[model samples]
Target: MAARRADLRSALPGLRRTLRYLRPHLRPERWLLAGGFGCLLAEVAFRLIEPWPLKYVIDAVIEPGAADRSGIVALLLLCAVALVAAAGLRALSAYLMTVCFALAGTRAMTAVRADVFAHVQRLSLRFHGSTKTGDLLTRLVGDVGRLQEVAVTAALPLLGNVVALLGMTAVMVVLDWRLALIVVAAFPVFVLASSRSSRKITSAARLQRRREGELAGTAGETLGAITVVQAYSLERILQRVFGADNQRALRDGVKASRLAAGLERKTDLLVGVATAAVLLVGGTRVLDGALTPGELVVFVSYLKGAFKPMRDLAKYTGRLAKAAASGERIVDLLETVPDITDAPHARPAPRFRGELRFEQVDLDYGTGERALRDVSLRIPAGCRVGLVGPSGSGKSTLAALVLRLYDPTGGAVTIDGHDLRDLTLASVRGQVAVVLQESVLFATSVRENIRYGRPDATDAEVEAAARVAHADEFVRRLEYGYDTVLGERGTGLSGGQRQRVAVARAVLRDARIVVLDEAATGLDRESSAAVRDAIRALTRGRTTLVISHVPEEVADCDVVVRLEAGRVVEYRPRALPRRGETVDARRR
Candidate 1:
């Protein structure tokens, strides 16, 4: 018991944070909530008067010898008035409460979604590089949806019921203490059952939710890369993995559902038993002449009303468990501090002279494997530096450092005289543009994809960028020219065309520094030459870094650097061998 209490106490902070997200709606809807409360109070007042009508009708009209027609009529009229008042007040409270909670739920949903998006954006590239895209999507969509369900179905209703339960219980005790004792005694059993079931179901639900996220991520990854699966013929293997995940989720869900159902059944049974006890004991009081028959009816009605909240609480248990799972996941993400963040006093880097220098930089991914070891190099402004190496030779790693994708494990990479780490990350990144081997384009128009580089760019600016990238002629041939919609990841476009669109995007950015990693990998000879020409046009007067495996592009660069075994092997200006001299002789 103590351990469970401690666990709940620990979760209190997260609950408070989740509730805080609802603050905006709470402040604005105070008047609506106040109106709702007013309606509730009126309903309670009318119920209190409900018993009086019965008492008067029985004692004055039917029970006593003075059973006058006019008196009976008056009592009937009073009873009708009480019923009408209660019905109106009940309807008003229900409507207002629903509206208020709905607004609050929507506000929480918006805040949580925004927090997840902003947090994902700020997280380190390494974090994103390693995390499954589907898992993040599940957090943003599925888990957030669970939270919304909790806010609407459980959180708000639970609050209202708790208040109503306390008020109703107090009134029952004041009206008749002995009958109230019967309810009070049974209440503890209901609370105990609720708490125990909630803890078990909530724990299982949290695990289920995590597994579901993994399942979603797996599905998303496979669907996105269905071509790879087909090429590799791994569909059966992936299906088995997905099946196992689904089976585990199913087992957990079944366990939670059975447990919640048992609690609900037990609560209902208790309500039945409590009603029986109230009737038996209250019947004795009425026969003993201590209570009137009409009073017994009212007391039974109040007992039923009190149990109504407890019955509804049983229904909310499952919803609360689901919400608790979502709450924990959201809290875990929101509380995680990013590995990379802006320095307290970071400033924008001064206009880069484009002097790139790596001073004995060493990097490790903490998995006992070094990606770069004691690497050193310098490239002056307006120079084309080519990085060439076999696979796993740190060629890509070097390019990532230039983009500040990951801070070096040791040493410093400087732009001009400023340490890249000391400059604000956004400022450094804003000035550097990267075009990778596979450029990702959205399911949108060509103009929109190019405009992604500079959202505020005018149409003229976008057209100019496309022209510089050598993509204007083809773009003009499209059905809507630049306005033609492209498929997801630029699916409808040809390989070279897609690459050119990517180049156009980078060209539009017009950053002072550019990094091209196998940027022309998929293009044919003609398209490759066109892309290379476009790249030359883009990189003029900018510090450019190219990671290449081909001799043609490497030969065009002003300086070539080679990497082997995570260390730079050579750095020199490229020149044709002397006439009648063998190139192999120079390598020795």
Candidate 2:
């Protein structure tokens, strides 16, 4: 009993947190909620009124001395018609109640899902780097969807049943407080049975939800790498791992079901005992003339109506618990604080002159390894600079700071004499264009993918960017030309083709500062040349930062900065290449 109490105490906080997340969303749904609850109350009233018609019909049949033959027939007809009317009205009220709640519930939950998605998108790269894509997706889609489904299917009806139970019980007490006491006497046992089983079911359901998320994560990871899996012939290995998690989820689901079933049977037993007791006592009273037969019949009907909710609670407990678990998961995600956000007084950045500087900056990712230490350098506006270093030498880290992907632990990074932190993140990132080694492309049309760089770009602008990236020819050759939709991650295109598309996206961005991080590393000689031509066009008058180890890729730079162990070891200047000179000249 103490353990049950403790569990309940622990769960209350999580339940309250879930409600907090729901509150704001519920505001927009207030009118719909009001109508739904009003209908629910009307339905309960109709239920209470429903049993009385049967009571009147029985009384009319048993009491002939009170009326003439024609009068009795007229009363009977009225009673019969009243019963039908009450039943029909009650059903209509229920239908309206269900529709209203379903609409409100679905809309509120959808808004919540959208909010979570937008929050996750705005979170820092560090958060995304540490989180699993599949788990986040489950929270966004699966968990939120579960909340909506259960709200409509299980929660609303259960709420109506509860209200009806209360109304019927009150009516029973007024009719015969004695029989109502008998029914009420069985309540404590029902409470005990349900409370214990409900907690257990909730625990099991929470575990089940987590395991399901893990199952999704595992499947997503494997499917994303199925080509590699087949190449390495490790299909059996991954299958075994996935099967183990699947079995665990299955076990959890079964456990919750078993607990709910136990509660239901307990409810059934209690209902039987209460009903038997009521019939015994009420029958004796009827014989003693303390109550009329019709009244006893009404008491019994109300008793059944009241116990029905207990049975329903037993039946729907597991589903409610799962919804609760899903709600808590969503709240947990919503409560997560993003590491980066706009400063309270931050303003939008102006169009930059593209001068960038790192002033004694330091970065620590909490791994006890300083990613950058006292790193300081300056790049003049519109100058082409190169960064050459061993892997993990903080070359990429420095580039990331320019875009405010991470803030320095100490010191500051500035763009055009303004600290990056002083500017709105959107404005800061908007003015910088980046093309990485393994650039990511979406499963979208060629024109749309390029337009992603600038969402409002026109068709002519997209085509122009494509031509500059040397991607226009191949894109035109696709089945639908520029309108062709590629596969996931742009899988239908080869590496070089994908890279070129990414370059086109960067080209369409038209930012004053460009970062090329090994953008041409893995391409074939011909493809590399084409991409280089595109890069040259894209960075001609912009401030360009090139990170590469290739001699020719950085040979035409005005400066080359080298780093070792998170510190700048060398900063050297090279004569600027003449107009129309190829970078290949330096390699030769």
Q: What 10-residue stretch in candidate 1 is worst by lDDT?
A: 579-588
lDDT of 2 by residue, 506-567 (tens): 99999999999999998899888888988998998898999998878889998888888889
Alpha-carbon shift of residue 280 in model 2 (angstroms) = 0.9
Q: Cα miss at 74, model 1 (Å)?
A: 3.6
lDDT of each: 0.78, 0.85
Give me the candidate number with maximum TM-score: 2
Residue 138 in candidate 2 has what lDDT?
Answer: 89
Report how far residue 537 has shifted in candidate 2, in Å.
0.9
Off by over 4 Å in 1: 1-17, 20-62, 575-588
**Total clashes for model 1:** 0
lDDT of 1: 0.78
Best candidate (score: lDDT): 2
